[model samples]
Target: MTRRRPPRHASADELLTELGRLTQQALERAELQKARVELAEALQRELLPAELPELPGLRAAARYAPARHGLNIGGDWYDGFPLPDGSLAFSIGDVQGHDVEAAAFMGQVRIGLRAVAATAADPGQVLSRANDLLLSMDTRLFATCSFLRFDPATRELSHARAGHVPWVWATPDGRWGLGEDEGGLPLGVLAEESYPVTRRVLPASCAFVLVTDGVIEGPAFPITAGLDEVARVTRAGVHAEPAELAAAVIKVADLTGHADDAAVLVLRHDRPPA
Candidate 1:
């Protein structure tokens, strides 16, 4: 006699309960992740300048690329704003971490540094003050930054670097070299240390390139090779305007496998000879 198969268990309520719990958990996780992403993106946007500062008699352009590897954007940032003395204040920096908190801290440091730079008029002093500010704050992040006070009249670039990548300059004659700035310490580090400012007399038709370490520190190439590529690209675009040159350099950097967040700012001196 064929035994009647035990009636299939029909616990629809129990099944529905399990499914509801799973769905609720999934929704909660999705909401948390979305909130985190939004927070990180907002912080990054706040850290960067909304628009490049207006400078009379000079043309400037910038390119920023966030890394493609994570939920939180990296800390690379570029900024340009007019100093109270009428000179252009230009800078690029990267905090050590990449997250919402890092971005927020970076925004605070960037604004504070700009104010300090305006008042101090000395890059080293400004950085020192920024370090003190960082130490006083709850955030314990560090960053490498380069600051330049550009004079359109004399084509002089007064610059200082705090553990950031060295800048490059391409003269009108096609000669290219690093813009070497002397002693400096990264912000949010030792308060007693100071940075040395270096001045460069750019050619009337020169192009100066500033960048963050993300362009040069990733895999597939060493930092030196990345710099060499930059030098090459700057020479190739020697005849282009600052904005055009910056675009070209950014393209080349991306092609060379810059997998991290990267930024480039180009300054082209075009004042007619007085």
Candidate 2:
């Protein structure tokens, strides 16, 4: 005790060395986070569709813009595929959270949907099976999704919602409308949740738009404002091709900070052969 253990102090060089080691660890962590983000972006590009499916009597286009805010890479997703039952299926969804976990889960959910669509004839039934599939996955996350089944031959469409936004429809004949699909609880929340199928007869040259909540309820843009803006721009772009129409709708959103990701999938009903 008298010696005092040389004041129980560390050498200057030793302290400096420890500081350096800590700084190195911090740098390593930063690098790891960056790598993860890059990986997520690449995975998203692979997972998301580069082009919409080719369906009869419909011109389809889609756009996916990731969020610009912190860790904005998230679970927003859209899919358009042809079912074996001779109908075109389109869906848009957002899983909870905005991290790599959510993105990975989104991939799983989308794959489940595509597989279930093959046999399920009704949009509501498709969603019900998808919900059960998701529940079985045991992921501790929920998602909102909207599914639509369109029969191009009869100009008929059926929509199902799982706590998702309604589709916006703008007609070439100067008619603007919104889907009447009823919303149920989000998927993975309840095993017995039932989605209602709402059917409508779409008119010729109608641009039907599907979007996530982020697309309509951003920090700067309220839902009503965003809806009005999208509807107006979509109507104005009604004569444009599907690709241009999607771009126009996105631009009209005027996204800033990208606090949340946005996806727009549009299927324009083409006039039948003369």
Candidate 2 Cα outliers beyond 4 Å, as residue runs: 1-25
Compose the digit string of candidate 1's lDDT tens values, residues 1-274.
8888888885999899999999999999988877876787777876687778755556788987777655536577888888777778888888888777777777887898888887987677777787788878856789888888887666677888888888888876868898766857788787767888888676667778888777766667777887888888898887787778887777755655666677899887766645
Worst 10 contiguous positions by lDDT, candidate 1: 65-74
Q: Residue 224 error for model 2, in Å?
A: 2.4
Local accuracy of candidate 2 as per-residue lDDT tens digits, 1-274: 4654556688899999999999999999988878877776777778887667767678788888877656677789988888996788888998888788888888998899999999996989989999999999888999999998888677788888999877788887798877756878899999978998888887666888887877777777777677777787888888899889888777644553247888888888876776
Clashes in model 1: which pairs?
none
- CA lDDT of each prediction against the hidden true structure: 0.78, 0.82
What lDDT would candidate 1 get against the real structure?
0.78
Question: TM-score for model 2?
Answer: 0.88
TM-score of each model, paired residue for residue:
0.84, 0.88
lDDT for model 2 comes to 0.82
Give the root-mean-square deviation of each candidate in angstroms.
Answer: 4.7, 3.0
